[model samples]
Target: MAFLAQFRAAPNLLTMVRLFTIPFIVIEILDGNFGVAFALFILAGISDGFDGLLARWLDQKTTLGLYLDPIADKLLLSTLFLVLTHVGIIPRYVTVLVFSRDFGILLIATLLFATHTLRDFRPSLFGKLNTLVQIVALLTILGEKAFSSHQFTTLNATLVRSIAFLAPLSAAQYAWIVIQRLHSAEDPPRRSAPKTGLAQISAVEGADPSGSTDRVAS
Candidate 1:
């Protein structure tokens, strides 16, 4: 019980640790140490999954965890994309599309927060699917290097193309949802004034300051 309690209290800390591993992974990959880089990547991915599950199972969910998890995932994936692209393993266009979507989302999120219109914008099915595709693409590309087969190369290329197309489509759907929610919140129904006894009394007083007999008195 004590062990579980400690884990629950520090889920976000685990996430931060995962983010820190990203730079090391990039450096290793750049140094032509794919073995260590690949291992670090897998460890990061496993920690990502573990943190979320641990938080839920231990009943230790926090707002910080909610934000940190996605940021960590983005940081790791975005860094890998750039590093892999730099090494000429993955296509540059796919990285561009992935980064563009992430940047656009961040910009929109900032705008919404600045306007005090931010809401609980949970990940949609499409967004989740896009992330899954990205992971598959990255892993497939890395696997191609590790295994070095014609089949892996062909599969990696196919995954790369799929991610390039799907990432933007998912991003557009997210943007549309944001716009719709914003518009709906900004255009609420006009409120009607209440008709109270005090209002009637005020009207009568204005009409006849002498307190002359009004319809109610009659």
Candidate 2:
């Protein structure tokens, strides 16, 4: 009963809906139903926007929701990137950059958690920017495919370049953040609390850093 209660919250239920929508969206893509996939993707995005707002409004934020929200977002975005690449809608290299950055961050976060090195996993600004870039890129590609629009051609090309640039840049930023936090942790005693003022605000503004949520987009 205790565990079951976690899913009872409105925000979490909405997140679960998004997770369940992913497979259908993938199937639509595989079946060459780009229009349907596009519609479903938009719907999923709507749910994502609402879940967080609902969490705050209803005071329903849970550890499970924090982790589940981003996992769903990543799963949806990453899977779409791969499938789009397979279908020839997106370039393989763009997907590669996306995967590489995400994998590297996940690897580092895992090590830190396992070793008990750091606890506050906040998303750096770069990570948030990367996530935005990736989202826009995906949406542009999907819209182009669904609508068969040549206008999106130039925009798609631009976003591709942005993704290529932002992926490694964000990864590097995350690396620096980790190093800073580690050093702060090792600080003699009083100089701890690595993030302060603007730094702390930026970290908390985005997804949860610990990769348990989107902020860590790390």
Candidate 3:
């Protein structure tokens, strides 16, 4: 019962709700209802930001929250990228880059988990920046389509190109960091000398059995 109290916290509940909304947002976007889709997307984003703030302010942070937050962000953003690209609002190249980077990251993460090489690797700054660009691109695309604004369309196109270029660059940076960390972990520290207190005895034994007594006496 004591443990159950932790799960009932406000932030955790909000995070859970955000996860639940991902599929609904995807469905609405696919149905060609940009208005409701945009609304749900905004709601999801707000919930995401609010939950983090709530967790920090109310001291309701949890291990589950840490894991769920990133997963929810990835799932929601990835789905939007795919759906919007499929419908021609988002450029195909942008979606391709986003998906490729995400796929690469997931693959590396899986390999690390399987090999027990990584226990905890938080998102890098580059990765977070990529996500922010993606979110902005998605919102701009949706906005342009919904409101029919030329200015927004131009901005959307610019964001799409920027995201396409940055996605792979940021992904490669993350991969390099992971590889360096993995190598550091795998290569254990080298000792300058055998750390045994019986080194003299072993040396004497190697030299001559009779020398053991002399070495001990000395």
- The C-alpha TM-scores of every prediction are 0.79, 0.84, 0.80
The candidate 3 region of ten consecutive residues with least summed lDDT is: 207-216
Q: How accurate is candidate 3 locally (lDDT)?
A: 0.81
Q: What is the per-residue lDDT of model 2 for residues 14-74, given as tens digits with 9 covering 90 to 100?
A: 9999999999999999999989999999999999999999999999889889799989999
Better of 2 and 3 by lDDT: 2
Off by over 4 Å in 1: 1-8, 189-218
**What range of 10 consecutive residues in model 2 has the weakest lDDT sum?**
209-218
What are the root-mean-square deviations of the candidates from the true structure over C-alphas? 8.9, 13.9, 7.7
Q: Per-residue CA lDDT of candidate 1, range 124-176, in tens?
A: 67899989988988776665565554677777777888889888998999999
lDDT of each: 0.81, 0.88, 0.81
Check candidate 1 and list the clashing pairs: none
C-alpha RMSD of candidate 2: 13.9
Across 1-218, the per-residue lDDT of candidate 3 in tens digits comes to 24567678888788788888878877877887777888888888899989989999998888777777888888889888888778777778888888889898899899889988897777788888878888888787777666766777667778888888889899989988998898998899987875354565567465434544444445
Q: What is the lDDT of candidate 1?
A: 0.81
Candidate 3 Cα errors over 4 Å, as ranges: 1-7, 190-218
